[model samples]
Target: MGIEIEVVYALPDEQVVIPVNVEPAATIQDAIRLSGILERFPEIVLEDRMVGIFGRCMALDHPVQAHDRVEIYRPLHASPADARRMRAEARRRRRAGK
Candidate 1:
């Protein structure tokens, strides 16, 4: 028998979710490959990337259960601290103009 799972990837302008069926023993990587998501999005390089199940990060080798939603994560363009700093600066600028 097989398990049904969803593999998802998102970009700023687009998102894709592919439903896949794999053997019960399949791992996250196996489901991803079976879904053909890699082919559709050539920019997804798994070696340096992180993946998750429902919002929790997991290793590529992690075994997937039925109905699992596997997500491919994109690298952050800015660190969390840097992003917060930028937002604070923007807020200060707005207040000064008012």
Candidate 2:
């Protein structure tokens, strides 16, 4: 039997969510391919990006379940540590100016 799932990808200005159905044994990668998300978003390269289910990171080979929300993650421009450091520095500079 086929399982129902949603595949999503977000951009700064837009988000795309596509509903798909796949075999019960299908993996995240399989659902993504069936969703036609890659064709719609040519910039997405599976090998270079990460996939997940309901916001939790998982391997492309991870088996999918019914009602799963398969998400394709974009590469972070900055690491969490770097982002935090930058924000703190900015806050410090603003405080000093006041």
State every prediction's TM-score relative to the real structure.
0.94, 0.92
**lDDT of model 2 at residue 41?**
90
RMSD (Å) per prediction:
0.9, 1.2
In the range 53-88, model 2's lDDT, one tens digit per residue, is 999999999999999999999999999999999999
Best by TM-score: 1
Model 1 clash pairs? none
lDDT (Cα, 0-100) at 91 in candidate 1: 100
How many clashing pairs per prediction, in order? 0, 0
CA lDDT scores, all candidates in order: 0.94, 0.95
Residue pairs in clash, model 2: none
Stretches of candidate 2 off by over 4 Å are none
Per-residue lDDT, model 1, residue 70, is 97
What would the per-residue lDDT of candidate 1 be over residues 1-98, giving only the tens digit for each residue?
89889999988999899999999999999998899988988888988899999999999999999999999999999999999999999999999999
The whole-model C-alpha lDDT of candidate 1 against the native structure comes to: 0.94
As for model 1, its CA RMSD to the true structure in angstroms is 0.9
